[model samples]
Target: MNLLSAGLVAAVVVLIALSAVAIIRADRPGGAWGRRLRSRLLLGVPWGTIVSVLFVLAVYLFVQRGYWHWTDPVTIPFRSWSYLYPTGWLTSGFAHAGPGHLRGNLQATIVLAPIVEYAWGHLPQERGSQSFASWRTNPWLRAFVLFPAAVLGVGLLTSLFALGPVIGFSGVVFAFAGFALVHYPVATIVALLVSSVISTVVSSLVDPIVTATVSASPPSAPSWAGIAIQGHALGLFLGLVLGLAVLYRREGRPSAARVWLAALVFAVVQGLWAVYWFRGGGTYVLYRGVGVALVLLLALLVTLAAVASERPLISGERSLIDPLSPLQTALSLALIVGLALVAYLGLGPPFVGSASVAVVITVALRILYTVVVRIAGSGRWAFGGITRRHVAITAVLLGVALLAGPAVVPNLVTVGDDAVPEGETVTVEDYTIAYGEEVPNRMVSAIDISAFGETTQINTSGVIVINEDRHIWARQVSPQQLAYSGAVRLRLGGVGWSESVVVRREGWTAVGNGTAYQVWLDAEDTPTQHAFDSAPQTATPSIDGRTVTVVPDDGEFYLGVERGNESLGRTALPEVGETESVGRLLFSTERRDGRAVVVAERGGTSVAVARHEQYR
Candidate 1:
């Protein structure tokens, strides 16, 4: 719609054109129309998977148009055991938080799925191989049915340990990468560099330009957001293991061993680096000097391995350079250096070290292949037809894709309208509580008591229950219970009770309330209530003993002063969630139920405050 979007669209058009040309050039010439059609349908395009995913995406978008929270029906909630929405395990993969999310996953699926399907669908027949001659072994069945099943299965498995609601097909994409690595290792690595690593780099570089032109916010740093990296990592791990097993059967034990060793080394180094960055402690530091020592160690080991493995056995005719051409060696070296640089600068410390290790492994593999050829003295060494032209094309496409990717994709442009019904009320005994107009099944109620204590009065209100179920439950503060403020704490039924307050003796406030609560139904249909507690008090004294109090009132805070009585000046605080200061005293608030807890501080010293009590 805007200049930035339009530019992105243009870039996508160019990419499509290039892809179409490439596909056409790659197509073989000697096949019948029907045979070619079938081949293209089954292997080239992955029509079934693509169509099904697209259909689901369309439906999700349609529902989101009317009911913004439509994904709630399909979201795989973190740590939830409830099988109430068993279908969500599969459906969540198709659901996305925004258009940008949808486009990113969809693009990845389009690019990677067909390649994986083709590789796995038509396995090369061996001379003395015994095959399972059944429907289960049919290549078509494997491509159409088994592939999707694996994707969904991996998606669901990864969601179990996700820190939050898991959605999108990123896990499946990673699985595709894993599978591709075994069958088409060179191509897959190139794709990963271009698609995942390079694209991210390009996106960040161009974001400022787009932001300036279109008056849009700058894009976030290239870190996983909303999408679960853990899920992707798990899928990749499973894919690697399965792929290795499959490749072992196809390529013999020695070949499989070499691949496994290379992958294991890479995985270990990368995993260690991640641990160092995220969870390193004293032991980690002692063993690896934080991350610096680890990186240096990795470099040493990789260099040694490369040198030892590539040494010329008989000099002259048996040298490492004899089998490989100078161009190939140069290209390999260039790629290694380029990739390592990108990994270090763009992806940070962990990946750079891993990339260096990978470079060594790749070089060692070539040397190992040459040695085997020399020993056997029969078969020619396999280099898989890598050429300067192919490298050039891949680089060009990677650049184009990175530059124009965001322009063609949709992003979260606006917040969706509230879909919750308005004026929803429920009666608990004689008292009536109002459910939040924007969040369904969330109740908030308030009651004022004339005499809660010997000389105090109280006004108490907050969220009683917040759940994702039909029946809502909350603690109803009856008029009779006002006399028993601290003595009789009423336990609110259901889950997710917002902060409720007990205002005692006018000025003295006791703001004890529950944080945001949600009830998760486990696989056994048992419900577990999860809630946090609001902080204790609000106002703090400044250098001059003046205090500013911000009280939570139904999603908004009422800012007031506690200076010399003066009837406690109360006014509506700004909607922005920022700490406000009056003179030397600073005031802040956090959401509790629908209300807020006012946190006040002065001169960095905390002030003790009394809890509010209701007088009957």
Candidate 2:
């Protein structure tokens, strides 16, 4: 069967099994499954938040269907001044790109938001009063106010410095996950694992169908892919900080310290992943895998720490055995080493290096804090009851902030004139030249090159690089590259050049006013340019001559064809390159001082020569 049919069959089977299981446990008293389900529905369902999220999803779908233009209104623009707009700042968190985006974030919100809300909603009021009369003493009121504020606040903060217009509730969802990590660790892990598995299975089954049907949908709808990872990272960091503060307020210094340590470990892993992602240019799959592994690792450690500290909390009795036993230390070191190895092999050396450095810095800071704590004495506060613990926590937080904050800079400041020695450069008789500009345009910038005694002016949409002495300018189309459709139009020497070509069902069409040309094989499998206007141009199977040249009508011309039937069937002349010959007839296309010259020779005599545009 095909992919769709197989997916349908699998889905049906899963549904039937789930239904049967539900039926089996429906009326059973003291049923573990039933009780667990009930607990999730009751305790883990933040009704107000979930309802608001659903409403937002509904509006998103409506907007996608052309009910209104919600994206621009809600999306935070990539400008520092745009943060002043409260509508976009607040609504952007709820605004998503598409259905797929909504699905992933909505599932996360449903599972994690409730757990976060529950944690915040159940905290004991001071003076042993669990009253709802005063907002200050009401956990539910505080949760309702604080959770959404955190979501919008962090979302706005991230979007202000984002590389592009930021939308979607992913940042908030990550924030929820971060909060759940500290408060309801077991439930959070279960939810995350189950959700991840389900999402993977669904994506695997549905991706083929979606890919096949994507052409049917309107292109106006923005893509749901390319998650704002920087925003998510910031949200996660903020959530951890918030969780640390809350844990300190409710549970004691020790619990807060354990949570802080766990957060540090997680932050280190995240920082390493960020380094790999932003600096090392790791793939999305590798970044995601490392993220999952880090979360699982953190969950395991946090759970163990919680269990170890539980006795002290309950009975006020410290364990006789030291917490950092040799075996435990060895296991922790082994785990860290194993993770580093995985990061090195799976991601890259940069990740491993960053992680190692981060770990060392963290360790040194911890040691320094310990020394200060010892010097200050255990019972005495350093200043006004602010002990070394507070300082250590602040230092750890600052370290984490430093690590996560810099990752966003690469995304934001994408345009700069940073010279690279890696690119290919050609040294002519009078000048040295490169294909593209050294600096990349984040949105749209001018390509100004003063090489070969000539000034070349072109509009660049992104990082334009010259290749092999050819005037072929290439740029990476990223979120930073194009702020909006048609935001930047590339032009070369006052003539507009198309950035892309289109292939329709009818035929292939180049999307520019310039002459479209290609090399292909003919019906008889002979390499030749038979008809210039044919839909599928004939391509010669073999090259009878060693070199071929194309003479242009108006622009500069001369193309070198070596070892093939190279045909430029365009009215425009080709640029110059190195010279070569098969027999006695010499053919060369050379550029000197911003000028292209095509020359032909036979029997050691110059046959024909052409000079195009002159250099300055």
Candidate 3:
């Protein structure tokens, strides 16, 4: 047997021996063996967490068809494209992008969710609370039903409010971490380490043996660049809200300092500080400084909100109905305005300054009128004259609102203008897929906003998909992405049906010049159509007063000899290691220097003209 196999076997034997030893040691009376299994489960096994994980897995395997095609699942229809697409809004949080995405989220969920569930507990912790006496206090009901139902509800909220067409259960996973962090900060961090170990084990099991070799890799963006920061923040706030409510009800407060430290570490490590925005044309900009500062502030605010005492901000003997002095009222108003401005501006560039001002004015006026009435008449003050806890909660909620409110403006938009580029397109149901270069990205441009040297009028090149009904005008595959990968398959569907559209790009790169390529769209039950053809590109090499050119015409590439726009002769490009003569120049293709090169020769003098790069 191989060395790895032998080691694995030995490890298994050692693990079995250790298990036997522990069981033997616990066999004595009053030992662990004497206790019921349920007693060790902290009220019961984490059935709710298990059920939640299973539900997400089932959606990926069955609903998204990851069962048949484990890596490439039907994803477009399941994304939260817009409010107009109810199916997408409902299923997006449950559906994942790919197998890797599903695995990563599930790994975190398996570790953190149990902690949150344990904190929730099967039986109520309230004074004199008895299990099974009431439905609210029933252990089985909480473990099997209530917890899972709450998770489902949170999933729906995340999907409905998340910006853009996001697909994944990652937001819910973050929620689990947030809630667990609030309850047991140190344990939550340890759970993160455990999660890493589990991930390593899974990876090792998936590939028991390893082989390494040098190879070219496809182009890819930074890992943190694609994170849905707004959605993640939204989920974290939601969890904090729920956790705080439970904490207050149970009168259990964790160490604020530990919570702050844990929150900071978790947020930074998990890329919650990776605040970024798309710059169109397959580019993204990250505001690292801004993101770090925001996360630090977020940690402090969360700590205060979760653990601060209910001491009134204002001192002295005063009833709830007592009128505040003009100075006090003025200071509160200024504080509100200051927070509003900071929060609003921090959520990007404020797409509509006038609208933002209007919102601030309207909200201020409503609150001002309410406060004036309460001061002039008799009623309980808001949150008992506003304690430190109330203020902290208000700040956190305001931050969440500012972060999430901007998403609504973008989500409310549809493809009202002509987003379909001027090119051959394949239509499936209400969707239109095409390939175009330098096409304006209507999605970003619709806001007509610019900031940090980035403008909304940016252009993009790639495979574009437009669904006016669903309010989707996305550049699915960028030019660089497609060039490196060579092909991409997209799935578009509605409630009960799905169809695939395969995009394949074939090109020949001219030496010292751009690529001459043709893009084809192959849809289900439809004949393959040539979608796009790039301009003819001339090679830098010259032979006998003629220049060899790679020309893409009518879905085929041809080798042409040209002399300053004057075509001497043209013929189909030669196969690899084969020759084709155009006029006095003989062109042949062969692999050299890890690239496919086309050489033009005359009188035994040859020069490499066009080349195609090979990637793994």
Candidate 2, 211-234: lDDT as tens digits: 343333212212213445556665
Strongest candidate by TM-score: 3
Q: Candidate 1 on 21-125: residue-level lDDT in tens?
A: 887677743356436545534544565466547654764545333134332322212122222334334355555555556656665666566656655553323
Ten residues in sequence with the least summed lDDT for candidate 2: 497-506
Q: Decide which is better by lDDT, 1 or 2.
A: 2
Predicted candidate 3 versus true structure: per-residue lDDT over 27-122, tens digit per residue: 853555334435423344789989999999999888888877788888887888777778888999989989888998999999998888878778
Give the least accurate 10-residue stretch of model 3, judged by summed lDDT.
Answer: 369-378
Model 2 alpha-carbon miss at residue 485, Å: 16
Q: Give RMSD to native, each candidate.
A: 18.9, 15.4, 5.2
TM-score list, all predictions: 0.43, 0.48, 0.86
Q: Which runs in model 2 stand beyond 4 Å of their true positions?
A: 1-44, 55-59, 62-94, 122-127, 137-146, 161-167, 200-229, 252-274, 277-383, 403-439, 442-616
Candidate 1: list runs displaced more than 4 Å: 2-19, 22-44, 48-52, 55-59, 62-90, 123-133, 137-139, 160-165, 194-209, 213-229, 252-616
Q: For each candidate, how many residue pairs have backbone atoms clashing (under 3 Å)?
A: 25, 14, 0
TM-score result, candidate 1: 0.43
